[model samples]
Target: MSNLPKTMKALVAYGPGDYRLETEHPVPVCGPDDIIIKTEGCGVCVSDVKCYHGAGRYWGSETEKAWVEPPFIPGHEFLGFVAEIGENVKGFEIGDRITADQILPCGECRFCKSGRYWMCQPHKMFGYQNTNDGGMAEYVRYPKTAVISRVPKELPREKALLIEPYACSKHAVDRAGVTNEDILVIAGAGTLGLGMITYARMKNPAKLVVVDMIDERLEKAKDFGADIVINPSKEDAIAKIMELTDGYGCDIYIEATGHPSSVKQGLAMVRKLGTFVEFGVFAQETSVDWSVIGDGKELNVLGSHISPYCYPFVIEHMTDGSLKTDGLIKRTFPIEKWEEAFEYASGKYGDFKVAITFD
Candidate 1:
């Protein structure tokens, strides 16, 4: 503990489209019930991109209040080693590899009392508010109430970093209720989309289809066990899906593309009584036909939020190699190159996931 520095470098978000890499930010103190972590790596998420572009869902829109308050570090998907353990904390030792559930639920909330903590009214996420400084830095503080799990030492940093996103995808797949007889279509091949494919494949679905505009991602999806890969930019996606499903369309559609058009496409491609799981964070509102969900198709639409109780399942899968991680993390950058890393992540540039690593 004597060797620990008083301050560390951190990426602070001041407001929409405003972020600064501060070299001398205070190293968070470990409260009696908190633990400090030395960040190993942090993955960039699509929400981070939306926040960077000043999307109203994160910043603020006329109808919705903003989720992010400024002057806080901005990273949620990360893994690291325990740096300082609090006096009252138990079951964790110094140097233990760990990653936490980003959402900190207020146990007193009604939803929390009902065991639905994911819907806690006053929940705080690690990366969005000052109270819980995020992992885009040399260190981060894990609150007493934060749900944390230890990572196996055998797991590579790149794969460990995927646990969070994979938990989210797992929850979406679970919600979709996929079975061996079901034909599943994942509407994107990005990190989360690919994560969905990884977990959905485990269900041994009759067929797993992946759709993406990028050929590289489509190929990667095929390598990741996708039975079919579609390049929507070149092929007529609706027509191809109909032909593949023999005009019945897909039994389940998982929408991971944030583009509004994907929502409409899912509505059009899913068969009557089919299930649709919406897992993307959009920049703006999408207009779709309400009748298609009710009278026209009677489809079952589900919304997937952040990782809730599925962290352990994801970690277990990653530990056993059931979840493929090779080539998922395409690039890594040191904290000094945050701007470059952020631009590369935002551009997508034919990459799956980008990470910021600490020395």
Candidate 2:
């Protein structure tokens, strides 16, 4: 405590287009059961970008509570080193590398009591709620209720930075329940979709088809484990999928693209009784014909939220090199250049991931 700085640089969100980098933000204090860490880096997520640019879902309407409680930090995909452990905290050291689940579940909730903590009734998420101060700053505080996990020091910065998204992606892939006989379609080849490809590959699906607009991401999809890649910008992706499956439709469709079109597209590309996993966050509500899900296709539509019971698997496979993330993160900038980093992240510098690094 004596050696740590009193004030540190931080990125604070006020409203859309009003995020400021404050040079004198006070260091977060550690409570008896809380943990404080020196943030090494934090990845900019699509939701973060959407919120910064005034997405309606984050802003909220008269109907729903605001997803973003402003005047707070806004980063969930982050990695840090334990700088200060609370007096009552255990199972962590002063210098342990660590990351946490995006969710901070209340232990007494029905979901938490049933071991499905990710779906905790309170639904408190880091970077969104007022209670959780996210890691878009030099130093971040993890509350007493945070579900923290130690990251393997041997893991590369690129992979460690992706643990949160990768964990959610793994959860979506697991929900798909792909089999060797199943033909799987994973739409979107960005950060989350690529993680789905890596994990879906382990399932040994017969043919893994990837759909995206960018040719480069489609190429990267092939490298990850896709048996075939589809560029909807160049051709009719849904029709091509139909032909591939001999008009029977794919056995599993995982929608990782946040676009509303992807939801409708998955509904058309999957066969009756096939599994449909929806994991992406959309900026607005998606409307579709109700019959397509029940009467028309009778599809098994499943929705996946943030990762639960997956950090251990992610850390182990990432350390063993089973989950590949070579060349996933495209660029990084110092905390001072956050605006530039986010601009490049919003597709100016390709559709890959961009991160903000802290010294």
Candidate 3:
């Protein structure tokens, strides 16, 4: 234990646009029921960007209080190698690669007690609160209550870092309940949308369509299993989906883009009595009329939060090479260049994905 460094580099948050990189941040100590990891890498997700910009969800709105606990490290899409294990920790060793779901249920909460821990009342997500410092630092501690899982050594660290997002993506697809006879249209070509495409393709939907404004993302969506890609900036996306479905509209529409337009477009592109899943994290409120949902379509509108029990299923596919990761994660930066990494992820450099690495 004395061999570990006392202090390390970390990105600490104070407020909007106030993330500071500290070189002498104290390295966390392992509690009796907790373990510490030497972070290998952490993915820069759009949620991190939204938080950086002080989105009402992360920061607070006048009506609804803030969700973020502020002044906490904020990278949830992350993984690392276990450097120190608590004496009470079982089934884990010092050199094992592992990761945990972002949601840290209190174990005694009603939802956690009933096995629906993803909706834990406290909603103590990592990277948001001080109690759970995220992987934005050189080292991170996993609490005794954390739901941990092993990342197979067979998968590359880059791909392994995707376990968290892919887990959420898999859960969204599962919510859609797609069938071979259904036409599924996913809005957005970002990581989560593409992830939805990957898992939805496995469901063998009649036609898997992706809608996005970016040409580059649409191109990669093809490789990820989108049967057709529509760029809304050029052509009418809702009209295109209707045309592909013979004017009936897609049987299922999943919104993964945080943009407000994606919400309205999905409502119009989904057929009557269709299933619509909303999985995006919007920086602003997306106000849409519900009349079309009740009086006109009677659609099954569903909301998906963080990943629940999909880690194992996603890990198996990732290890077996069934999942594709070509254009995704096309960019990386050393922790020293985290500012650039964040800017690149905010679509400044047109990179598909951005990750900050640690040694």
Candidate 4:
């Protein structure tokens, strides 16, 4: 082994409104069952903006109370190749292509033992804190527990980077319990919303209607297999769905936009005995009016957190090209141009799913 540097260059946040290109960070070390991976690609997600910009802090940790010093790496959703493996690491070797779950769970926790590692006690996340430095840096170390699955040789790095959000959508679909005959409505045509569209299409629903504030996103939704697209800004989304469904609303209404108003709209748009899935991540407190569901609507509202038990399913879909993602990835950037990537992904430059590619 070469003598590795104790510090490396990484894009670090000094504080709120304070991000800079910096170096001299200690490289994460591998444990007995850990694996060190050299990042191949990283995606710029909206959650990253919430943490770096002013919307909210990552992991709900106060800015001043964060563990690592200012200027830490950022980017949890990524794909990489194994650079090194720990002594006890098996079933994987150096040069193996893989994507991580980004969630580090305590295997001893009851939730983890029960195959609910996503809800692991003392849960730590990559790129959110020191748990792992994440892919924004040159390399990251992860205990075997974090490795989700090996990336298929046919799956491009760009598509593999989508596994994280895809797992999220898969979890929502699993919880929503959409079947071949169910009518479904997805609110918000953004990345997460689009992922829902892609995954739900696998179920071959009777009708898949997508509602978005932006026409462009609605168009993207159509490309992702939404049977009908409605721009809520120009039309009454709920009324449109009702008319399309011949007065009865969709059997499943999913709220992918964090805006509470959209959630409320979904509630009003779903039919009685329908399922409402909440997949959006709200940065601030939100409120909803329940009167719409007061008259025995027989509604099933499910709150979905980060993914669990769906990594393999996501990987399979991505590998087979059944879920087309290239249309969803709007831009790619070199790791050095992360700031530009962030700007493009923030909707400032009219881009979606911007990814950072490492040489």
Candidate 4, lDDT over the whole model: 0.79
The C-alpha TM-scores of every prediction are 0.96, 0.96, 0.97, 0.92
For each candidate, the alpha-carbon lDDT, in order, equals: 0.88, 0.88, 0.88, 0.79
lDDT of 2 at 318: 80
lDDT of 4 by residue, 1-359 (tens): 52446766677766666766666766778778888888888888888877777553443356434433344577888878888788898888778988778687878899889988888887777776655567787777887678458888678777888898888887888898988888898888787778889999989999888988888888888888999998877988888888877888889988888897887788878888789888888766677667666665868889898778778888998888787686678589886788888888887666768888878
Report lDDT (Cα) of residue 86, candidate 3.
84
lDDT of 3 by residue, 156-243 (tens): 8889878888999999999989999999989988888878888888899989999899998999899999899999889988888877
**For residues 1-359, what per-residue lDDT tens digits would candidate 2 score against the true structure?**
44579999988989989999999988988888988899999999888888898777777767766777878888999989999988999898889998999998899988899999898987877887556878888988898888888898888887789899889999999888889999999999998999999988899999999999899999999999999999988999989988988898999999998889999999999998888999888767899997989999898999999888898898889889889888988688898998987888787678488899887
**Candidate with the larger TM-score of 1 and 4:** 1
Badly placed stretches (over 4 Å) of model 4 are: 1-7, 57-71
Report clashes for each candidate as comma-separated counts.
0, 0, 0, 2
What TM-score does candidate 2 reach?
A: 0.96
TM-score of 3: 0.97
Over 4 Å off, model 1: 1-3
Cα error, candidate 1, residue 301 (Å): 0.9
Candidate 4: give the clashing pairs: 12-71, 12-72
Q: What is the lDDT of candidate 2?
A: 0.88
